[model samples]
Target chain A: MANVIPPRSGTAFTLARGQRLTVIDPCGEQVADLVAFRADDIDEVISSGRTIDYASRIFLTTGDPLYSNRSNVLLEIVEDTVGRHDFLLTPCSADTFRIIYGDKEPHRGCFGNLAHALKPYGIPPDRIPVAFNVFMNVEVDGSSGAIAVRPPLSRAGDRIVFEAKLDLIIGLTACSALQSNNHAFKPIHYEISS
Target chain B: MANVIPPRSGTAFTLARGQRLTVIDPCGEQVADLVAFRADDIDEVISSGRTIDYASRIFLTTGDPLYSNRSNVLLEIVEDTVGRHDFLLTPCSADTFRIIYGDKEPHRGCFGNLAHALKPYGIPPDRIPVAFNVFMNVEVDGSSGAIAVRPPLSRAGDRIVFEAKLDLIIGLTACSALQSNNHAFKPIHYEISS
Candidate 1:
């Protein structure tokens, strides 16, 4: 099945083990926050820390394995059109908006969108996990240990693919924040297959 | 209800929001790896990174809020007897045993025990999250940034209490690893109350 996740919106679906899920940026420069859990036990989830530790690298590319906290493989990158993706940053939230944009208004960021999408599956708004930022460009300054978000390098129609190692409940959210007038976020396309 | 989790064994239970779960070191030298997830969604789970970032500290104590990856409050430390817990280390696993102990023999560490306990709840063995090591004395050397395991400071009947912020499925495992000849592991007691 294929679906389009609108800008600032979210969607959820189940991917059986051995199945594949692909996220596409129809228009370049968009970021998608993705979260996944074991279908049988929601508590066992994808761990960014474990993934980084297991891969021995911070950025993920084709052939990298995403691991859970228990050191179990969750997903494997089977295909990638864009070579850069971030596994070091946490998903943006309302609290992040308050800090970065100085906006006191309720801005449901990727965290809120994910919670809203997974609510019917029994996930509460506050229980959303940190995510894998697909198509996002983040770089670390080695000497100072500072991280900076840069404009994505992916072109329109670029996509990344992952093969599930277990039955997984996956959530995807199109980011809502904008870096500047030159950069604007767009919707993401999803495709899942057995 | 109260239950005694034997040394080298594990247990699982569900706690509704607003309820409390207390972990007690019955014999004073035990370490319990505690992992929690949102009862409904399972995918939104405890994240050591988020908890540390949110609390702004690596060591946990009373009044500290444990946050999930989405920055949601999972549990609050309402009571503590020893006042020290670790949120920086991942649960010990078979692979870790190979690295630390150089033993090729099959060893069931906290990860295996937690997976075994949570199996009945549909959680597989690999989904265990990084745990909060309760009653475990792990000290880090500031100069070298090296962590060393030591005997627990808790006395018999010493415990820590967490008030759940959401419905949670918690798994607790009595550590099977031994520090040395003088340091031995013991059973852990669990108590849940509204």
Candidate 2:
């Protein structure tokens, strides 16, 4: 069955090996934090450093492999309607809000949502790793090494698809960036199919 | 009950808030990869960048607070027999073996051990985060920005203790460095008490 993750919340599910999971930004401008783990073992998870090293690319697109720390291929991107997915950036957390916006009040973010969604399965908040930010616009200036966050370029109905390399448990969070003034945050749609 | 994590293996357990968890280097030369997640949420995990930014020190000692990505205090080092714990380094993974030693063969490492230990709890391999290396001797050269790995200075009963700031699920892995020629690997002892 397909799932519709509400804006600013998260969801978790198991996708069998060879099955494909597609994430859709139904109304565009929303960022989704995508994370995955091997169904058989949670510890040998996707490592951004390793993935960048192996793929020889910082920005992932179709055909790119998401690698685990154990050197295992966990997922392969098969389709991308938005080509600018970021695997290098860590997900926004409460600290991100405090540091960037000087907002000390606890706010909803991808980190918290992922934690809450996985709590039922015994995964705690601290176990959440850095995730792939899909449909989020983050640009780095080469000269200054400065990063700028912008509105996603994807239009409504845009999606990214990945073929699972192993039986996997996936987590998705409608990012907290919804609170930002630059973009409109909207609900995300997902499907896992063989 | 207390646990003895075998060399090159890992185990997971929950430590309630205010509880203390001590990691003992029974044979002195071994290193342990310590990772924690807030027991209630898995996404707001330990971040080396945040911890370093908050502590203002790269090497951890008693009184240093390990900060999560959300800027929350996850653990406070309350006691230490060796003051050189490193929360900055990512755990040695299978890729480490392949890159440094050129060994394409699958080797036992902390990443694998953690994934195996947490499997029953439903954490997948992609969820393991960067870990705090307890008793691992990693020295950084300031002038050249180079790093060197050395045998730990801890003695046969050296240990470090942390008071949980939040209820937590902690994972400890006997590091893969046990296979390195510079040091001998041995079992690590752990205890959780009020």
Candidate 3:
């Protein structure tokens, strides 16, 4: 059964090694932020540095491996329809909406959502690292080193799949930021296959 | 008088709002990693995302404001001799040497050194975010999103200066990674001016 993560919300769960996790963008242009931690030891979490350093590229896709802070492989991309995802940016937080969007009343963004969702597993807010932002469009200017967040290219029903290489605790979010979701928040769907 | 941080070491201290910090590469080609946290609240730390978003560029220099996660300015570059500094890479760790350099007896790199130095201040390992890498040369291939580490462009006696926007707890390191410092290790110098 497909699990539905509602708009501006998130969920957390565990996956055994070799399990296939598929994240679906039920609606076009919505973004999902995903994070993983070693099930046995929470300290050994997913690392954007290790992942990008080994992959030699920022935009990861099929066949790419997700690396942990300890330099261990945790997940591998088995399928990807949308090749563009962001690992450089941190998941949007309450500060994001206030600082960038000038929202007087800030929304507890994806970071907040992920923190709450993963708290039961004893993961604290500071334990969160940069997430692999799925279905998010970020344009980086190479020469100037400038970054821009654009609407995702994913169409409705676009999905990406990952095969876990280690027992892991995963956090997934239907991102709450306005600019990240093209100013419209929507739900996300995901499923696990043994 | 400047405080000398010995090779492959780190230190942590506090700075008042409006104070100035000068980090010096006393030996050319050495890299230093720097991080700042709000004195009033440790939860509000220096954010590469907020800094890059506001600066609109990765190679930050004089006049660029270092932003906190809360979207507030924490530091501003008041002076810079070597303009290129990396806000993207995390502080190198014991795992970094083991994973990238294949060192069996890994030296505790900047990350480990900073962790030890800041332990007394109530910051756990997980709270540490990406440090501003000073005097390190990182070549980013924009189109492919590839990154390469190169020797620092800074010469002996080169320096970068920052003015604090808020009272801060600052972490400073003389990076231990062999690659970031051109296969050599050297000391760092810093001084605070009111």
Candidate 4:
């Protein structure tokens, strides 16, 4: 059975090694922020720096391994429908809305949602590193080192699948930022299988 | 007198609000990894995501402000000689050497150095985020989104200066990674002025 993450919310659960977790954009054009920590030691969390340094490319796709801070492989991309994703931006938070969007009433955003969901497993707030933003379209101007966020290109039913390489604690969220979701909020679906 | 950090090491210190910090590359082709946090609260630390989002560019230099996670300005670059720097890469760690370089005996890199230097301030290892790499040169291919490390463009005596907007606890290093420093590590010099 596939689990559902409501719009602008998140959930945390455990994944055994070798299990496959497939994240689906059921309504399309929505972003999902995913983060993983080793079950035995939360300190060894997924690291965007290590993964990008190894891949030598900002746009990661199938066959790329997500690496941990300790340089161990945590998960590998086995299947992907929409090839674009973002590893640069940290999860959006109240500060993002206040600073970037000038929102008067700021939403707690993905960082807050992930922190709340992962709290049960003893993952503290500060340990929340940059998330793997699935289906996000972040364009980088390599020459000027500039960045711009664009609406995701995912159509209805687009999905990406990852195979866990270690026993992991995972936090997954339906991103709350309006700009990332083509101005609409939608639930995310996920299936865990051996 | 300028405070000196020996090659391949780091130091932590406090800077009062409104004071100025000048980080000097006394030797050519050396990288300095710098991180700062609010003296009152470590949770309000320097954020690469926020800085990049607000600056709209990756290459921060004179006139750009370094923002904290809370959307507050922590430091502003008041002077810069070598314009290029990196905020995308986390400080190199033991895992960096072991995994990327395949070194049998790894040196504790900038990450370890910063952790050690900042430990006394009650800042745990997990609190270390991506740092502002001063004087280091990194190239990004705009079309492919690929990254390449180049030797520091800084020559002897090149300096970047920052003025504190908030009372700050700073962790800074003469980067240990050979590639970042053109295959040689050299001491970093800094002076704090009112």
Candidate 5:
């Protein structure tokens, strides 16, 4: 008889082909923070260039390679149906809450989650940098140069694989509740294993 | 008679209604460390859900009130484009640089700029919280329940205005670049005046 598996929530990790990590939306909807970093001296890591080269395309699916400031490979996409991803935009701050979310000051985005996760690694919030908008699509109008935010073109049960070039500390967040946007906000499943 | 004024690279202003403070391109835009506190007492402030209500949104404009972690209105959005913004994703940090840029960290885009600006004010980078995604459209997707990172529908030269709720310390940077994951990567202009 075949073995039975229970329902899985959140990410399922499976590392291979260099170093692969996948973050599942579990619920088959929504895009969350799945950031990566190159490790240096355990708790030390760095970002790539401040800007993402994808113009407005957000989302990280198959074949995506996250570059670092050092020009070394950080994270590479091995498998992903969640096409473009968002790696831009820093986590929220007080002013952000005030400007965008009037009267709301505290909300946890990718940056907050990363800060918390790295706490065990002796990293604090002050150390969090701008994240790559993985598996998210942010497009710019080539003609007018306008920015357009859209939903993930990927579907449910999709996965993005990345091979880590060097030792790295990847921060994953199953994006919290984003009820003010559009269809892109859905429960997404993730997995990462070695 | 012709009234000749000094030449300015970008627009200069005290920040009025319908005026945008800046445009953030995940590809190259970056805002640094910022400190928000009760304008009354700049000496002491709070952190993590003290001054700001994480559940609510705080609407701001030029010279409007901006509360701190201690729930004291601190700074204000001297300029903005998107009327309502998000306070969740703030500026860059050390960890942020590591995650996005990786081991080969870019010299810029870190919270260093924020800290540098705060140094003169006797504040530290730790005091700054996440920032607002001004001009950037981050709507909650109903079907996916995720905050979609979309480009702002606003046209070039469009504006979002806010008032300083309180006297606050803010550090900003026009992201030099984002090679991580493409979103909105462009030169952002910031202006401040009394």
Candidate 6:
């Protein structure tokens, strides 16, 4: 789609039913680690549950459909490589690492490494929820609705891919280097297979 | 919570009965035109099939508890306007006005100004769906799960207010310079009253 670009040492595909997977990032600076499950019972995804409220932009190109929390249907992109991705926002937390490294260091972030990577599969770090900080840049102020979190149109090795119709356990946050308002601290690399 | 802040010419506070409103935007470019309806039938807004899904930032900020989609308890955020707000991701069709200006002109987006500002009531515009780009900054490539789309961390005025708990008819796109990849053309200004 973007000149058949798909080879950076990390690629894979599959999304049969109702097919459609697209993800493009060209050189927007990679930061993908999506997780899915349920295609044939990988461990139930589509689990935003409670009818799902909102938040999904930390990057996930195309029509953006990988809902769960019990909503089901874990894949639907079709194709893309830089068309634009940033699914809501994530990649920095713990009160944004104590407001950008304050609260006297020793602060564990990225949701404390996603609770030590799901604490060897017992899950519980307050349930690991707030994630998805895709391309960075956040704005919201229509007459005092303030929200100016920017710094990331993407730069450096950018990438985006999708095609997992269902069956996902995707969980990635390879965005270390505690940054604020957007990039200054770098280190983002990702890869996934079918 | 951040010391009362909501006056961009929008008011209607009565979230009393159990106050708990919290709508911040840190820096995501404000866009909060909320509603809940039912403070004794102020036209009803308890269920638009359950709203507030700013994609997935989770709703009712002040401790959280908006629930709907059939979960119930429509309001909570008692008081908020200390930051970001802007959730209305889709509403610019007709090929996005010929792909953001040049398929001619006059596309009017945001579902034609929210169906001409609610067409004096009767509402229509296919019920309008697909919105919730609050704090925009999409990126989905945790190893090929593509979903790029970018731009927007707020730039202009900057606000965030939400205190109704119920009584809604919200609809605002206000800005649609369009170009896909998550709005980056220009034109933003939205407001809502009690």
Which window of ten consecutive residues has the lowest lDDT sum in model 4 chain B? B136-145
- lDDT of candidate 6 over B1-194, digit per residue (tens): 23222321122234544343443433244333343334443333332212332223422234434433223455544444332332324444443455335467556544455556555555444334444333443333333333333454554544444444444444434334343324333333333333
Measured against the true structure, the TM-scores of the candidates, in listed sequence, are 0.60, 0.58, 0.90, 0.94, 0.47, 0.26
Error of 4 at A36 (Å): 1.4
lDDT leader: 4
DockQ, model 6, C-alpha based: 0.02
Q: Point out the higher-scoring one by TM-score: 1 or 2.
A: 1
**Best-fitting candidate, scored by TM-score:** 4
Recovered native contacts, candidate 1: 0.05
> Candidates' DockQ values?
0.08, 0.08, 0.46, 0.58, 0.06, 0.02
Listed for every candidate in order, the interface RMSD values in angstroms are: 7.3, 8.3, 2.4, 1.8, 11.1, 14.7
Off by over 4 Å in 1: A180-183, B1-89, B98-103, B106-194
> Candidate 5 — which residues are off by over 4 angstroms?
A1-17, A42-61, A92-99, A103-107, A142-148, A179-188, B1-194
Clashes per model (N, Cα, C within 3 A): 3, 17, 0, 0, 171, 133
DockQ winner = 4
User: In candidate 3 chain A, where is summed lDDT lowest over 10 consecutive residues?
Assistant: A48-57
Q: How are the candidates ranked when ordered by TM-score, highest leading?
A: 4, 3, 1, 2, 5, 6
Better of 2 and 4 by DockQ: 4
What lDDT tens digits, residue by residue, belong to model 5 across residues A1-194? 11111121122122233655655544454555554544554323334222232211233346656655333456766776666665534444444445545646455544555667766755556555555544555553322223444665545555566677777766655554342123434554444455
RMSD of each candidate? Answer: 7.3, 8.0, 2.4, 1.9, 10.5, 19.3
Error in Å for residue B143 of model 2? 30
Per-residue CA lDDT of model 1 for A1-194, tens digit only, reads 45999888888889999999999988888898888888887767777645653454567788988877656788999999988776644667787667566787957877778888898788666445557889877654432223456788778899999999999889898887675111576888989888
Candidate 4, superposed: residue stretches over 4 Å from native: none
Alpha carbon lDDT at A134, candidate 4: 96
What TM-scores result for chain A when each predicted structure is judged separately against the true chain A? 0.95, 0.94, 0.98, 0.98, 0.72, 0.29
Estimate, for each residue in B103-167, the C-alpha lDDT of model 5 and write its tens digit: 46544343555556556666554444444444434454322323444445545445443444444
The better candidate by lDDT, 2 or 4, is: 4
Candidate 4 C-alpha lDDT tens digits along A34-68 = 99999999988998877887787778889999998
